[model samples]
Target: MILTVISAWRSLLAVAGLSLTVEGLYYLIRYLKRFRERRPPQVLFFPAPVTCVRPLLLSSPGHCNCSRSHRESALSCLTRLLLSARRSLDVCVFTISSVELSSSVLAVHGRGVRVRVITDSDYMALAGSQVGAFRRAGIEVRHDQDANYMHHKFAVIDGLILITGSLNWSAQGIFGNKENVIIIKSTDVVKEFIEEFERLWNEYDPSNYSFSPKS
Candidate 1:
């Protein structure tokens, strides 16, 4: 009778261990199935011949070569934007004084790129020489400093990339203090910026726009 009771107890313990093992496996399988269903489907087929949906190239402010002075990383991003520009370049700014940045504009013009600049009236006198260089390069530069205190900073490149921010084209803004900016690579965003630049460019008459040199 003693031996029979011991045998029964061992059988019960074995059954309990097996039951727990099965329960644990059931929960694990359920969890794995749920996780698999939530995962996104893999696309094995290409939508546009595998080449059209090509990788979207991206570059941030720190990737490009910029002057060492500016803390906002605007110049670095601006350099990348300028390098990526093709066909056309549109810039709308409130002030302009940075030689390196202006030289980037001039360089693009020299490459047969169409460059258009919209500036503020306050600095048109100071920007005369730079503007002349743009004109000499067959680039168009206009100012609307009189229109509601124009204080915008946007640059549209090739009708595709848009760079808009609080950082002006000035040396101080680019290389000095903290500033905010957005570099948008979406076509829709670029179109919106282009439209805004053109609207402001047309509102003011360049014929009546004039600036007198400092006395």
Candidate 2:
């Protein structure tokens, strides 16, 4: 019995030795490979205000099953940019209906930020449209019903930050459809979106209508 126990202990030690040797060889090979194929750094430093906010790319329904998490994430990213407004906000999107996003718009507007919105005219009467809410709050909101398609999803914050993405401001656009939004801090880009918004706002503005500034 004692001999058998001793033999078992010897076998255990042999296995442990073998494992240590294998581990040592693996680390040594990894170190050599890294040393032989060392690469340069990939990130570049920029002096300008070029930066990236959280990017939420949701998978499309056909590509992958859409979940509530994806929708909420996309909405949150939009809301984050909305809440950061201080001076003025110019929004040009196809449609918008998320209560969370609408609430954020109202919040920033309430704090004395100038808010202008241009959307698709057909969506004004859509079931989930928040056009009424913005109009009621005295926000300058218009719709390009006359145009064949006013398909733009972007927001310019204080004429300094620009948020442009594929995601619409609706339940499906946020949570269901696959989308990408890019927020950039460039005056030239912001100017381009602002110009587009002005062109649409002018075309949709009716002489008989009036939107009084609440503040």
Candidate 3:
């Protein structure tokens, strides 16, 4: 009788242990699932030392049979870079008249990415300029109000890639005139450009604009 009681107690204890183990595992799995759901998805960018240059010299008009070759054009390269922004896009340029580039900016903005544009105040009012369109689209745009030109032709994409050079985001700059664009993925270089962009963005804020009294 005593032996039977001991065996029964052991069996109960063993069953309780198994139940606790199963419960622990169930809660562990729940915790892991919730943690994964809370974490943001990781995005991998191209490794550093990745650089691209544009305004690839085009073959003589008749000699170039394939229009697809123009995909390497500076405009196309810039547009592709702009479209690659998953988090943010900072554009600081003297002027923006290229419809393709503007469209890319708008597209990224529509994707819920933060888009900020800084351009020359004077040029923003000029005809055929896309700065106005950017504003109408509800994207934040800032421009230098002083007499000096806000002559910057650089864009920091996702704070990872830096696109800069003599190439203006304009039809003439990309297609007609000789121009150059450099796309770099260096962390150090991109950090500097990001700082500059933030500084200009703050300096050009409407709240910081000053008006001189008329004499």
lDDT digits (tens) for residues 1-215 of candidate 1: 99999999999999999999899999999989866544432111111111110011222223324333333333544664676677988988777676656777877777788888987766666733366666777777777745465788788888866777777666566546467667666565677888888888787657655556546
Q: Which residue pairs collide, candidate 3?
A: none
Colliding pairs, model 1: 70-175, 121-145
lDDT per residue as tens, model 3, 1-215? 99999999999999999999999999999989776544442222221121222222221223334434443444555666788899999999999987767888888898899999999988888888998788899999999988899888998889988888777777677656666677777676789989999899888889887776646
- Candidates 1 and 3: which is better by lDDT? 3
Q: Provide the overall lDDT of each model, using Cα atoms, as 2-decimal numbers.
A: 0.66, 0.71, 0.77
Q: Please give the range of 10 consecutive residues that has the lowest summed lDDT in model 2.
A: 41-50
Clashes of 3: 0
For residue 89, model 3's alpha carbon misses the true position, in angstroms, by 0.3
TM-score on alpha carbons, each prediction: 0.59, 0.61, 0.66
Over 4 Å off, model 2 = 1-72, 208-215
Candidate 1 Cα errors over 4 Å, as ranges: 1-74, 127-129, 145-147, 205-215
**Top model number, lDDT:** 3
